[model samples]
Target: MTKIRALSEADLPAVGEIYAHYVTATAATFDETPPGLQEWRAKAEGIARAGLPFLVAEVDGEVAGYAYVAQYRPKPAYRHTLEDTIYLAPGRTGRGLGRLLLGELIAKLSGTRARTLVAVIADSGDPASARLHTAFGFEEAGRLKAVGFKHGRWIDTVLLQLDLTK
Candidate 1:
């Protein structure tokens, strides 16, 4: 059985590895290089310090995927908006884990002061992500054409938003 819970310091290595796969092997993320364990720990700590939600999905005590929300922008005007990031292990997609992770993350955020949740998807071809967000009531907000270049091609970012006020 898979379980969702708050991220822990022990999960950093697995989380970093899961994210490294996407960073190096896919356009799911535009990062050219993956951060080390220390970087992941520091980032997790910072997010926790900011009182945001950072979650992980564990299957039989193994980290299968993770998700988190961060301030959409550093400016005070954007305080009520948050951006989500979710990633699953290389072989973990299409198995309902994405939805589980994202669902739990969204539930945790609902009680917060955030009024909007945004998902900045890297590729339109990533239907699973689009579907996951859509399943959770996120609507397409906008699309930026060829805004990112990765894997020798220009990539478009699809922006989706969910109103938390409702």
Candidate 2:
């Protein structure tokens, strides 16, 4: 069974481990190095302070994935816009876990102060992330070509957006 809940301090290590794999093996994220606990701590704190959620997915009691949103930009004028991020443990994709996490995220944020939820998907030749986001009603807002360099090649980013007010 899969469960979704608020992320806790105990889950940060697992979260880091999950993200590290992507950093080293794929361009799913632009981060070249896995952030330390302090960075993770700061991230959680920042999201919490913004009155948003840092959520985790537990599969049979194991921290299998996490999802969260942060302000799309630092300006107060953009406070109502957030960018969504979701990641799963190695060998944990294609089993509907991303759907669960994203569904819960959208459900939780609907009709709130968040007027928009954005997804910045790295175009690493894998369409999984884009497919997943579009399946959730996220529309293609834009794309930036060659904005990220990883795994010995240039990478583009596909921007998708969901209107929370809808």
Residue-by-residue lDDT tens digits, candidate 1, 15-47: 999999998888989898999999998889989
lDDT of 2 by residue, 1-166 (tens): 8899999999999999999999899889999889999999999999998888889999998999999989999999998999999999998999998999999888888767899999999999889899999999999999999999887899999999998887
Q: List the residue pairs that clash in candidate 2.
A: none
Candidate RMSDs in order: 0.9, 0.8
As a whole number from 0 to 100, the lDDT of residue 156 in candidate 1 is 97
Q: Which residue pairs clash within candidate 1?
A: none
Poorest 10 consecutive residues of model 2 by lDDT?
104-113
lDDT of 2 at 138: 97
